[model samples]
Target: MLRLRRPNASLVLRALLVVVLAATSAAANEAEKAPPDLARGARLYSDNCGRCHNARGPAEYSDAHWPLIVTHMRVIAGLPGEQARTIEAFLRASNNPPPPPRRLGRLAAVVPAAGLSGSELIERYGCRGCHVIGDAGGSIGPSLRGLFERRQADWIRVQIQTPREHNAKTLMPLYGLSDAETSAILEALRAAR
Candidate 1:
């Protein structure tokens, strides 16, 4: 009978350690790779979440909380795994986006306009799709220029919140504008030349 020498215990242990180290190094490298596509995530978020709720900026939530929140929302919104992951990646990336580029002759950071700006509110509700505001806006409805001169502030507010109340034949849709949004729109219209 031929006798076989037993394997060396130290050699076996060293081999195991090398394998472990290699695995760890590979995992670290994977972790350091570029993050997922944030633009895709933003689109996913807007298409799904923005339908019912305001599409809040990603910086609203912390990195740790985003995964959990998005995971929960995924089920409620019936989102697929890939879409949820993409949105989570976008939220993580946007949580701390780079600062805006510096502009020449720009005034030192003035206080931002309170609440959503008028232009933002208009765009958000697709007001330009039906009404002409300035040089370039929609013409389906009456021009928004000199609206304040024609309509009272209260009338504008009422029309925005309840369009049909003012005109039975009005094609304008009610946006259920918040008080802040209403105020901002009014301010913007008033400031328009």
Candidate 2:
């Protein structure tokens, strides 16, 4: 009688290892080929980081330091490897955003923040870049439809000046705006529809 021979354990084990390695390499290659989506990363960062404390500013850490920070947070926050890498990319990208129009010259960095109306202040600072102040703006942040009604004046003021004080971590850039600028921004937000 002819008998069927069983496959050798060593050969099976080697083949399994090869398959596993090939799969792993393919996954790594795919990840490398795909570009990190900054918008998705930003959303992920907002969702994950906000769950704990607050969002952190991209400029808070240097490019060299961002990887380490993201890795640590990834572990603590239990974020996936791909997501953590995306966040790192977003942070690094944000840390070095494109340059604005040089036509504004030296004074562009620090608008006088005086004699400007609330709406003017908002426009000057590009508040609409991240928040939907009224009918139009980016969707990155919450809509500033009813600011004063929702939050105390002091709280709003603090948020404008230093967001970290409230949430401990946030990607909101500190504009170092003066009292007048902050007040103007607060008023504009209050008047937002």
Model 2's TM-score against the true structure:
0.49
How many clashes would you count in candidate 1? 0
lDDT of each residue in 98-180, candidate 2, tens digit only: 44324434553443445688787776555665566788665557777776678888998888877778876565655566665
TM-score, prediction 1: 0.41
lDDT of 1 by residue, 95-126 (tens): 64344334323322332255457777665555
lDDT of 2: 0.71
> Residue 153 of candidate 1: its Cα lDDT?
92
If scored against the real structure, what TM-score would every candidate get? Answer: 0.41, 0.49
Please list the residue runs of candidate 2 whose C-alpha ends up more than 4 Å from where it truly belongs after superposition: 1-18, 97-142, 146-170, 173-193
Runs with alpha carbons beyond 4 Å of true place in candidate 1: 1-115
- Worst lDDT 10-window in candidate 2: 96-105
Q: Relative to the unseen true structure, what is the Cα RMSD of model 1?
A: 13.2
